[model samples]
Each structure stands twice: as C-alpha cells, then as structure tokens.
Target: MTTAPAPPSLPAHQQPGAPVPLRAVGPPRLRALDGLRLLAALMVAAYHYGGRDGEISDAWGGSPTHQFPTASQFFAYGCLGVQIFFVISGFVICMSGWGRPLRAFFASRVSRLFPAYWAAVILVTAVFALPWVAYEAVSPTDALTNLTMLQMPLGVDRVLGVCWTLWAEMRFYALFALCVVLPGATRGRVVMFCAGWTLAAVVAEAANNSVLDIVLMPEYAPFFIGGIGFYLIHRYGPRDTTGWAIVAVSWLLGQHYAVTRLWHAADLPNAFSYRSSFGIIAVVTVGHLLVAAVALGKLRWANWRWLTVAGALTYPFYLIHEHLGWVTVHWLHVTLGLPAAATLPLTVTLMLALAWCLYRFIERPLTPRLKRSLMG
Candidate 1:
C-alpha cells in the first residue's frame, strides 16, 4: 500500500546543458500508476473506517437499515484496491531496478519501505496505544510488534490490522530480489521463478493446509505474478504473448483464490453469506483490466502537479489512515456529541492532515538519507 519514491535521474530534456549530478538517475514517472496509488489508498481508507461496514471491513453486509447500496458496494470491496497496489508494486519494483546491481536494488527497496514505515509505526503506536496527551491505551506489545512490521510472522499481533498487507509485500520483495540477484538474470529464469512460485501457491492451496497459508501467504502470489507479467510486456514489448498469457492465468487464479478465501471459507459471522461469490470475481477482473489499460499506454498523463502531489502522499496516507481514522471517528462520534454523518468528513480531513505532516516530515526528508546511509 506504500511505495517509497526512488531517486530520479535527470529528465532527458534537461540533461545536455544543465549541471546534473553524475549518480543521479530517475525512473520515468508513470502518472497514471501514481494516480492509481492515490485512489487505492483512499479506497482502502473508505473500506476500513469511512464506510457503513463499520471499523472492520469484513462486516460489509451487516448494516441492515443501510443495506447494501451501490455506494456500500464500493466501500465493501475497497480493499481490492490493495490488489491494484500489489500489481503496481511488481511493476514498480521491476521498473525501478532493471539491470541495476543487486546492492543498489536492495538499498532502493529498503529506503522506500522502512523509513516511512518506521515513522508511521511510531505515530500509530502513540495514537492507538500511547496517546501522549489523551485517549485510551492499548497493549504495549502490539506497539513493539508493529515496529518490526512483521507481527504476523513474528507470532505477535499487529498494532494495526492493515499492516498484514506489508508482510505480503515483503515476501514478494524477497522473492523478486532473489530473482534479480541470480548469477545471471535472464527473462526465462525470472519467468520460471514466478511461474514456479505461482504453481507452488496453487499446490499449497490444494493441500488445504493452514500452516502454509500462515507461512507462505501464497494466496496472493497470483497478483504479484500478474504484475511481473505486465512489467515484462511493458519493458520488453507487447509481442511477448507468453508474458500476456501468464498475466491472464494469474488473473484467473486470483479470482479463484477470492472465491475460496471469501466464499468457501467457513469463517466470519455469516460464513459464506458475508459476500456474494461473484463479488470477488468482479474485483479481480476489474483490477487486471486497470493494469492492462496502464500497460497499454492508455492511462498516461503529462504529470500534472496535483496528480504528483496525490501520488507523493500515498504511502504516508496509507500508513496513517486506518487506525488513526477510526480513532478520530470514535472521538468525534462517541466521545463528542457529533453524529456519525457529521463525523465522517472530519475523520477523513484529520487523517489527511496527519498524513501530510508525516510525508513532509518523516517520509519525504528521511528516506533518501536512510537509503544513502545504508548504501554507504
């Protein structure tokens, strides 16, 4: 859900005559993907705290009086936006480090993930557990476990539920990094690794073992694979129908995973009744279509300032939105006398304000330096 911006090399237009740093090289910006990132963050925030589904998103169809309207449906399925982020992450990770040294690749990814993440972790800890000046308190262990951002894998609960996605993201990074660091990276090898991984995931699912789900998180493999497939198609060429085929297969499997995870799983209060079987299919289909459109050069824009700003704020926005927003809503509606209807805008505005501060202060300033120090 969060992307650390990579250092940009100079634009071709300003390269020849201008004095630019020798080590400076920036990946070309994909404004459309950036826009998508912004949208995904907002969607998840809406899905979590903004929607009538209540604080927990899985309680989607619970509010009988509000019933499920079109707006409700949008909020209910908003977490699907994370699938969009996963696909984008695969694309971004590839685009960010094509042929770069493995060291540089690692440094870039570390820089992009941990600095802001750590800061967000600290802020969220204070807000959710250790509010400096006010509010109720939560477990200290949760705050500590969250600082690692590996709570699930570490056998500790997360300080924030949304952080589960980060573990999935980290696993994808580890797998992709392994591919990039092979003795001699080749298209076939990368393809083989991703395909093999997806196959393993399928097998794991088929085995019906809960342990593999906890350890591997293979259920999400298809999205990452689809992302890599699209990246191959874009970076190499469209004629690579092989890559296109992988993407297609991945999309199909994603829908399949959705069905089993959401529909067949006898979990949740209502079990299979929580969501329609078709809802998951629709989400996967639409997500891939967006990725396809982006790869086809359809969503390109000339880097409008507003879009750039929105994109810049995405990572921090994602980091701070969920728990903090819910806390704010509780304060406004429960603690204060404000009605639920009146508290929604205030909650959103408060989260945005907090995100802006985090981006400007911690995320923006510290990331490059942290990366540089690690590289040094």
Candidate 2:
C-alpha cells in the first residue's frame, strides 16, 4: 500500500489575505541567555566601580582604596561584560530576525531599542545637565552625535555618560540591516554575513592599537557572529547535546576569565585582546573557537525568571547604573566612611533595586506602547 503524502511545506510568507499563524514556530525561550545578561550587567557594574576609578570619581566624589585584596584585580577586569552583551545581542537579534522580512525585522528592532534610548537621553540631559546649565553647555555637534548614535565616531561622550554601548549596538544594527538587504535576508545569507563580519573584525583588531580602535574595530563583530552562530545551532542542531555543550563551555570560559590575569591582546587567544602586532588569523580563530564553545555550553535554569527580569532591565541599568551606582558607592564610602569592601554588595543591591524600578515603571510600560505605535 502506498503511504499517505507528507504534509506540504509551509509557505515562506503567508498570503496577503490569509490568516497568519497565531503561534508561530520559532526559537524557544532560552533563560540561560537571560541569566548570561544578568551576569554581564553585574560584571560591567563591577568593572566600572572596581577598575575605572577615574570615572567613579567624576560621577561620585570619593576614592576608596581596594579592601578586598584576594580578588580585586580579577574583579577589576569587568569591562569585558560589554563584549558578552555584544555577543549575546548578536545571537538573539539574528535568531529573532531569521526567516522574517527585512522590513519587519528592522521595525521590531527600532521599536524595542529607540523608545528607551530616546527617553534615557532626554531624561539624563534634562535632569543632570540642567542644574549646571551655565557650567555645562551641550555642544551642538555632541548632541547631534548622541542623538543619531554616531557619537563614537565623532568622539562625543555618551549623553548619560554610560551609553557608549548603544552606539556600538546601533552600528551593528545598521550593518545587519545592510546584510539583510544586500544578501536576500535568508538564513544562509545571515550566516554568511556573520562569518564575513567576524573575519573583518579580526583583521581590524590586529591593525588598530589605540583605545579608539579597540572601541570601534571589527573585533566586536566576532562576538555578534558568535551569538548568531549559537542561535543557528540552537535552531537546527541537536538540542540536548548542543545545549549542554554551550552551557558548559560558557561557564568554564567565564570562570577562567574571572580568575586569570591574562590580558586580551589582538594577537592573543582571549576575547578582548588589544595588542595588534601579533598573528591576526590565529588569534581570531582561537577567539572564535572560544566563543563558539561558550555559546554551545550555555544552560537554561528553572530559577531564571528573576534573571529574565533583570535581563530585560539590563539596557537601562547599563545606561543608569554605570554612573549612578558609582556615585552612590562613592557617597556611601566617603560620607558614611564605609569601607570599599562593603561597597560592592551594597552598591550592587541598590543598583538592582533602582533598575527594577525603572524597568517596572518606565521602560516596560513605554516599550510595548512604542512598538504598537511604531510597528503594529
């Protein structure tokens, strides 16, 4: 007897008049990724406080000596958190955009990112800069740069003093948009684009030695590419084996970075390498391998609901806390004579509490409304 014919493949796009699927089949919720976001936020917070003493002084007003001698240096290396955020964003955005129209993808991104960003810029400039209006004049060029997310190239400071990453992310979005348009917006095209971007990032890292170069180079592309690669593997590969691998690898690399003093050199194997004269190809290859391993080993947990909330708040927290948290910590340390050791936990708690408030009252409410108005 002949077997019944298999069901026909779903159309790439639903017909104009046809009803769309109520529950579309796509990537599953990855709580581990949310947890990773939480971890990255914490790292960045710690990095700002523990490492960048100069920014801390400018934001707050005191200089507290390091009291925790055991792991102070290790904790000081918290700037790498931005790199983690970059990679994670790449993966999530790519996965979300896969199989979707380029216009829809771009619309969704603009809806999610722009509302909070604009609000933050306006809020910060109005509240923080107004009181010192005579002393602090907003430069037209800087204002334009910050508003258009082109401040990094123009050497303009972030509006809130902690919004540099927004520029990097906006640039990545532009590049990805270009990729979608030029290469047909297919899954394979996205993959190819990521691969090419990663290679370019490697070369850029190797060629540029200045701090500006590090901030503006192709080195970041690999992290984003690594993220996209993770998404693809999660989407099509064996869930059980691949998921376990990702969780394990990410944890290990995180731990290694946490404990070691090895600086990331452009010619090195680590993710944040800065030296440029060394072998570029080998370093990039190793960096990519490490990132791939970490992405493969990420693990989802049942207790990640809180982390998911934290992750949602991370962007705003990154914007606010880098300055506010340091200010708070410094005030407490100087005014109350609190030791530096006490500042870490207390500051983290306060930042988290403030971030939660912003997420609940401001960002969450505005985001959906903006999305509906802009994209729906």
Candidate 3:
C-alpha cells in the first residue's frame, strides 16, 4: 500500500506522524515578543532623545553630555535596539508568513507598514514647516516621495530619520516573499534560503560587491537569518540540527559585523562614534539570547495581555519618534524653558500618548480597510 502525501500547510520535510507543536500552527500571537518589541522601541527612542551626537545640543544650546550626563552614557548603547528590532522582525515575519499565500503576505505587509508611515510623514513635514522649530522643513516633493516609502532608492531625503529602517525591512520582505513564501515556506526551503543568503553575505563582503551588499544586507542579514532559525526551532522542536547550526553561525557572523561595520573610530564633532568591539558584541549577543530564550519557551511568563497593546504602539512609535521627539524635546526644554529632567520624561510620555492616538485613530482603523482593498 502507498503512503499519503504530507499536507501542503505542513513543512515539506515534516515526517509522517511527526509531532508539530501547537504553538507553531495555532494563532500567531506571542505576547512576550510583543513586549520585547516595545522595549526595543523605547531603546531607540532613548537613543534619539539623549544619546545622539549634537541634535539636543543644537536645539537646547547645551551639550547632551552636560544635560544628560548619566543617561547619555546608557542611551548611547540604545542604538543597538534597532538590531534587536530587526531580529524580532525576522522571527515575527517568518512566523506570520509561513504557509501563507504570496498575495496575502504582500497585502499584510503593505497594510501594516503604510498607514502610520504616511501619517508620520505628513505630520512631520507640517511640524518642520513651523517657523519656530529648529529643523528645516521637508519640501512638498520630498514629503510626497516619502509617502511611497521608496524615497531612499529615489534619492529623496527621508522626512523622518527612523524611516531608513523601513527601507531595510521592505527589501527583506520582498526577498522573503519571493524566495520563501511564494515558493511555499517549508523546513527544507527555508533552511536553504538561510544558508544561501548567509553565503551570499560573506561573498559580498569579501568581494566588495555593492549590488549584492545592497540586496543581501550583509551587516543585518545574520540577525534576520538567525531569527528564522529560532522560529524553525520553535515550530519543529530544538532537535533540528540544521536550524540550531544556522542560528549559531549567524551569531558568530552577526557579532563580527556588528563590531566592524557599525562603529567608526573618527571623532568628528557631529558624528556618533563607538569603538568598543566588546560592547557591540555583547549587545548583539544579548539580543540573540533573548530571542533564543523565547524560542526555548523560557520567556513564557512574559505573556501578559497588556503586551498586546504595547506591540501595537511599537511600529507607530518607531515611525514618529525620532524627529518629532527631537522637536518636542526642543519645544519643551528650549522654547518653554523646562529643565532637562522634566523635559525628558515629558517628551517620552507625550510620544507614547501620541503613538496610542496614531494606532487607535489611524492604524487600527485603516489596516483592515487597506488589507481588504488590496486582497480584493
């Protein structure tokens, strides 16, 4: 008697009678991951607020070091938060997109990314247009281009500094959708994609190939790759050797790139520089271990309901936080003459409140409508 084929929804390599984890195939919500996302957003916000080079000083007529002496020291490390965000994005995207249709994947990404991003661009442009604000206004043409989220490739300046990460994310989504999702994400195919991408990254680095570097994202690819491996472990159990190996190799290469590629040694006045390879490696390692812990079920205790709300706020908060937060900090501290002690917390609280409003009034309402239209 012939045996029956495995279901299409299951990984291609899943053996007959293999025990698929309920957590993998069930509802995709992981509250701990949601909470982690919010933490990452807060880290980025802190970096923008006090750890940046000279923007605070430019706005308030005092050095950031002087105003936020103790905080700046810690916040300086907060830029690593973006790396953490990228890793989370990898796991979340792979989890959400596995066994999904290509069009559905595209629609989900578009609906999720564009609404708050458009709102942010429009709001930021208006804010910068105010004569009292210290920053120059983004021109109408640039603002229009920014709404497309393709301004980086079009050679137009981003209206918000944080939007650069969105470009990286877009490229990743496109690649993953085509190579993995379109073909159907399976254990074998995903493992191959991860391995191929890893090799491509090393080749790009060694050959100084700009085209491959742009497509492959040599510096950031390992985190994304590792995240995918962790998800595979979560879905199929940690017994998978290839998945665990992929994660290990990614960590090795990721830390190397984090130290060598991220920081500059020059002491330019307005440019941020961090030369501590140890600190860079440590931060990246910690980020990896955090996600790995989640995969291994060590963070199951973190699944609080409020983390769902926290996750919703992360995207919009990240989208609007950098430039607008800077403006708010300047307005409160410089224009209104509030002390730095008061300005910092006030700015953070106000940004969080604004993030909620953006999510509730804009993203929550628009996402479904946009998804329906795109799917239709």
> Each model's TM-score, in the order given?
0.82, 0.71, 0.92
For 256-338, candidate 2 gives per-residue lDDT tens digits of 43233334544555232232222223333334444454445545333457657867877767776765664576567766777
Best-to-worst TM-score order = 3, 1, 2
Badly placed stretches (over 4 Å) of model 3 are 1-24, 264-275
Better of 1 and 2 by TM-score: 1
RMSD (Å) per prediction = 8.1, 7.7, 3.6
**For each candidate, what is the lDDT?**
0.70, 0.59, 0.84
The alpha-carbon deviation from the true structure for residue 208 of candidate 2, after best TM-score superposition, in angstroms, is 6.5
Q: Tens digit of lDDT per residue, candidate 1, span 196-294? A: 888788788778898776645677888888888887776555656777988988888887876776564436564213456787788778778887777
- Candidate 3 local lDDT, 135-220, one digit each (tens): 89777888898889999878898898888788899998998998998988777788899999999889998889878878989988
What local lDDT score does residue 96 receive in model 1, on the 0 to 100 scale? 66
lDDT of 2: 0.59
